[model samples]
Structures are given as C-alpha cells and as structure tokens.
Target: MIDFFNNITNSLIFNNFFLVLSGLDNTILLLLISLPIGFILALLFALGRVSKIIILSKVIAGYIFIIRGTPLLVQIYLIYFGLGSVKFIRESFLWYALKEPFWCGVIALTINTVAYGAEIFRGGIQSIEKSQVESGLSLGFTKFLLLRKIILPIAIRKVLPSYGNELILMVKATSLVSLTTYMEMTGIARKIMAKTFAPIEAFIAAGILYLFLNFLMVQFVKYLEWKYNPHLRLNN
Candidate 1:
C-alpha cells in the first residue's frame, strides 16, 4: 500500500500538479470576467422579459429559450469557429478580441451564464411583492428609483442562492476551456496525461483541485447568505 501510494505521489502526474495549480489563474480569470458580465446581461435580459413592450419581452424570451436549449459546447464552437469563419469578422476591428482562445472562452461562458442567470433573475423579479412596489411609489419614488432602491435589491437577495450555484458551476465549466486550447486546469491535466500516460492519477489530482476551489466558493456564498439574511440579527 505504501509503495502504491508512493508510485502515485512520485509520478510525473505529481510533479505536473504545480502546472495544474498555475492553470488555476486562467480559470479564475475566466470566472472573474464572465461573472459580472453575466450578471449585467442577465439583469438586462430579465428586465426585457418583464417589459411592458410585447416585442421586447418576446425577443428577450426567444434569446433565453434558444440559448438555454442549446448545449454550451455547441455555443462555444459556434462563436469560436463560426464567427472566425466570417471574412468580415476576421477583418473587422473586433477580430483581435475573438482571436484569443481566452476571449473566446470568456465570450462563450459569459453568454451561456447570462441566459441561465437571466431566467433565475426573472423568476426572482416576478416573485417580488406588489405591495413593495406600491410602497415605494407611495414614498414618492420614481419608477427608476423604485427599481434601483427597492426591486433590484430584493430580487438580488432572492436570486443569490441560485446565482451562487451558477457561479460554482461556472468555475467547473472553465475546464471546457481546454477545448479552445486554453491552458486551464483540465487543459494542463490533458497535457500531463499525454506525457505521463497516467490518466487516472492526473485526472484525480485535477479533480481534487477543482473540488477545493468549489468548496471555498461554497463557504463564501454561505457566509454571504447568512450576512444578508435580514431576519437574522448579527448580535443574536
């Protein structure tokens, strides 16, 4: 048993563990860039879905339906290859942004997260009490002020649990960056496996790293939830 453990620990898979750790920076970068972009886009899409304008709501709903229905891998491939195929896009000023694998993965993940988060946010918004809006108005708040000061805050709190799940999922999803040849955790693991021929060991190490990250994020979200729970007083 000791020999077996040593074999796993002393293998090339073990040495390459640092390489995997390095790739975490890339994974984190992707998450940081994508999360806020997803959040903003989600808010816009949610508002559009709830808009009084029929056409606006329909268009947003269609976007949500199409995006949610499609697989993320397909979406990534479409944006990376399909958009790159366009001569006009290739020649355009924006091509520089699309040229990088990092950006491609970011764009794909951001768009995918936005679609899902928007639906979550929409549900939270719809769940808000009509009395809250009326109360805001009674206090001489304009529509914009009411939404900003009252609706958005309450809706955000309601959506926090789901949004936290989405955030962790996004952290795992960054593994898909390997498909685009970005050297994230999974990408580095693939490289190590190729060199070491120890697929199981390498993958197990990578899985542990991901598990650690997700664990940290989960704890952070729990703390935030506790802090934000209005019914719970800190002094108590």
Candidate 2:
C-alpha cells in the first residue's frame, strides 16, 4: 500500500510539477477573462429580454434559446473550427484573435455564460416590486437612472447566489478549453498521462486542484452573500 501511494505521488509530481502548475494557470486565466464579459453581456441581454420593445425582447429570447439549447462543446467547436475554416474569417482583421486557442475558448465561454446569466438576471429583475419603479419615477428619475440606482442593485442582490454558482461552474467549464489545445488543468493531465502512462495519478492531481479552487470560490461567494444580505447580516 505504501509503495502504491508513493507511486501515485511520484507520477503526479513527476518532472518538477511545473507542467501541472502551468495548466492550472491557464484555467485561472480563462476564468478571469470570461467572467466579467459574461456578466456585462448578461445584464444587457437580461434588460433586452424584459424591455417593452417587442423586437428587442424577441431577439434576446432567441439568443437565449439557441445558446441554452446547444451543448457547450458544440459551441466551442463551432467557434474554434467552423467559423475558423472560412476564408473570410481566416483572412479578416480579426483572424489574429480568432487564430488563438485562448481567445476562442474565452469567446465560447463568454457567450455560453451570457445566455445563462441573462435568464438569472431576468428573474431577478422581474422579482423587483413595480412600486419601486413607480417610486423612482415619482422622484423624477429617468428610466436609466432608476435602473442604475434602484433596479440593478436590488436585482443584483437577488441574483447573486445563483450567479455565484454560475461562476464556479465557469471555473469547471474551463476543462473544455482543452479541446481547443489550450493547456488548462485537464489538458495538462491528458498530456502527462499520455507521456508517463499514469492516468490515475495525473487525473487525481488535476481533480484535487479543481476541488481546491472550487472550495475557495464557494467561500468567497458566501462572504459576498453575507456582506450584501442585510437581513442575514443583521440577524447574525
């Protein structure tokens, strides 16, 4: 049993473990780049969906439906390969960005997340009391001012818990970036296993890293929740 344990450790820590660390860094970078963009786009999409403008709402709904209906892997493949194969895309000014695996992964993740976050935000927005909007208007607030000062804050507070889950899920979803040849944790594990013929150890190490990151994320989210939820804070 001791020998087996030592073998597992050695396999996972082989070659100074720099490769695995690099892979972890890649995953972190992907999340950092994708999350803010996703959040912003989600807000816009959500507002669009709930807008009184019929065309705008329908367009946002269509975007939400298509993204939610398709698998993320397929979306990644389409962005990375399908559009990439086009002569126009390949030769266009945007080719520089499109050619990179990192950018492709970011774009795919951002779009996928925007769809989900939009729905969450929509729910939060809808939950707001109509009286709140009326009160804001009575105070001479414009639509934008009302949203900025009253609606968005309350909606964000309401949506934050679910959004936190979405954030953690985004961290895990970075694993799919491996398909685009990005060297995230899972990608590095795959390479290590192929070279060393030690799948179990390599995968176990990667899994542990993911779990650790996720735990940290959950704790951070909890802190934010505690800080923002006035009722919870006062009770505590």
Q: Against the unseen true structure, what C-alpha lDDT does each candidate score?
A: 0.89, 0.90
Q: Which is the leading candidate under TM-score?
A: 1
> Across residues 7-104, which tens digit of lDDT does each residue of candidate 1 receive?
98777657777778888888889988998899999998999899899999999889889998998898888888889999999999979989898999
lDDT of 2 by residue, 1-236 (tens): 99997886665465425667678778989998899999999999999999999999999999999999999999999999988999999999888988999999999999999999999999999999999999999999998899999999999999899999999989888999899998888998899889988788788778878998999999988988887787867666
For model 2, the superposed segments whose C-alpha errors exceed 4 Å read: 1-18
Clashing pairs in 1: none
**Candidate 2, residue 106: how far the Cα is off, in Å:** 0.5
